[model samples]
Target: MQFLEASREQGIVTVTLSRGKVNALNESVIDEMTACIRDLAVDPAVRAVILTGQGKFFTYGFDIPEFLEYGKEDFLRYLTKFTNFYGALFLYPKPVVAALNGHTMAGGCMIAIACDYRIMVTGKARISLNEINFGSSLFAGSVEIMKMWLGQKNAEIAVYTGALYSAEEALGLGLIHEVAAEEDLVPRARRIAEEFAAKDGAAFGSIKKLLRGPLAERIRERERASLLEFVDIWYSEKTWNLLKEKQIRS
Candidate 1:
């Protein structure tokens, strides 16, 4: 199956991440996703978008095999990939909703947080930006972007401790907007997006821009730092072992 898929109807375009295995992000998925969002960003028919994933995983973050194989270069490429990958959701002018089916951790959580609205399933699904625990540091701008948007306290605790939060806990902490029973997630997320679509497009766009403006500027300035840091970790033995401990490969 294709790593990324988009189908638009009734003003809603749902972009699905269904890369096999853990739905991990890799080069192919990154390239396709960047192109997909760029295309929709220009399409007038797409008033709102729902970003989701298949199976029991939203994304396990980056594919670990590449990291193990390429060493330092993989890290640089990983950071660069996400800068462009996450750039889409951050820059998309319209409302974007995240319907996280499962395992939204590390990079998965970052993608969800970038959305205008987020809805995740309750139960045992875990979500977090857990790079620190994985022995990987976030791209420099990710610090400020996450701090401002997810709240400074969460940003500090989440990164420092690298803990994953349950859906209920996330709702309380404001990382995600709502939580639903697993099966109701996509429909509920669509409902939320449709409601937002009914609002004044210009007003919504303006407010989002206002909220994201400073952080977006910061991301632009330090986007390359993520690449540099990523490459540095690529050479770390700790990083390699973690990938193996997690039993991940290309």
Candidate 2:
């Protein structure tokens, strides 16, 4: 399957991340995603966007093997691109929903949080940001998004505990908007989106902005600063070595 795949039906644009098994976030994935999102964002027919993954896992996080071989410039460039992709998601005019297919971890969970809401499928699959376990941390923008979306304490726990939660646990913690049986996941998510899409689009958009208005400027500023800081830190030899270790361990 392609790195990114999409199908438009009615007022919904469903994007499936199908890079490979246990799909990991990489430059190609980010690039394809940015373009897809850009196209969808402007489509008059697209009233909402639903993101999902294939198989028993949503995403496992970054591709450590690729990162380990990256040099200072390589890492920096990668991050600049990544941050820009995230910036697009953060400020998208329309609501975006993540249908958490399965086993989301580290960068995977972070990406899910970028959406306005998330729906998860039931299973033993775990979800979390385990970057700390890998001697890394969330990008500044990621942290801010989590803080704004999940509250300060919940965000802290997700980043610091490095603990993975079951679908039910994620819902209880407010990490996911709802959970459903595997078969019901997509339909249930669609029902939720349909309700939202049926509302006055302008009013819906306004409410979203109203709620986030206070933090919009701050979030945008952090997004820019994060892009620069990410580039600067990616050059660290320690980071390269850590990536190498993660690759070998995986």
Candidate 3:
């Protein structure tokens, strides 16, 4: 895929985001990722998957500069594509792990939480869903994903406060499963992926479905109706003005 780096070894697939400096998610990036993950889920040779970003960022989140370029119709299409990708990643049958190498913000945080486990790299990097900071709204399914991992209160606080937490803080909040030095991050992730790959594929997938299916279905149902509205708000004058002001300040 143009936006990602995918490699398979010993039944494990590692997919690294490589679109730009920070691996921001856009319509094309989402499409390619969704397709790749769906294929891996069904591939018999693929026992597990690791998702990560290529450089200093796990991902900087959605392509806001691109978002500003979208009109209503275009934004709606983007939102729908993103919603579909989120659903696919959340309910992926094979084991998925996020190797957080650096800063992960907004939509990037959503993708990380969808994985079965998250291993964050230690440093000055942070993770957050700062949508509210820019007057943007979270996708309905994204809210569910956050709640599934952080519980109701922590999820609400994280989204609403638009706070950036250091790796240790994120771990304390249960946003990530483990924290490793930057050099050790990928190896740690690979070790975990191997452990998960050792499980019986069919039974493991089935049990995962049984455990996470309800929430995945809930996200799908909400996105079907709310994505359009999300696009509307994203294109609204209020949000645009807020974005403009933030850009000027920067």
Residue 86, model 2: lDDT of: 66
| Comparison by TM-score, 1 against 3, better one | 3
True-vs-predicted CA distance for residue 187, candidate 3, Å: 0.2
Q: Which whole-number lDDT from 0 to 100 does residue 216 have in model 3? A: 81
Worst 10 contiguous positions by lDDT, candidate 1? 66-75
Q: What would the per-residue lDDT of candidate 3 be over residues 106-127, giving only the tens digit for each residue?
A: 8899888888999999988999
For each candidate in the order shown, give its overall lDDT on alpha carbons.
0.80, 0.78, 0.87
| Best first by TM-score, ranked | 3, 1, 2
Per-residue alpha-carbon lDDT of model 2 for 1-250, expressed as tens digits? 2587788778988888886678888888888888899988788888988889888778888887877667767877877777777666766778888888898887788778878889998888888877767667567778887787668998898889887899998887788888888998888778777877887777877887777665656766676566566545544567556656665222
Error of 1 at 124 (Å): 1.3
Q: Clash pairs of candidate 1?
A: 75-230, 76-231
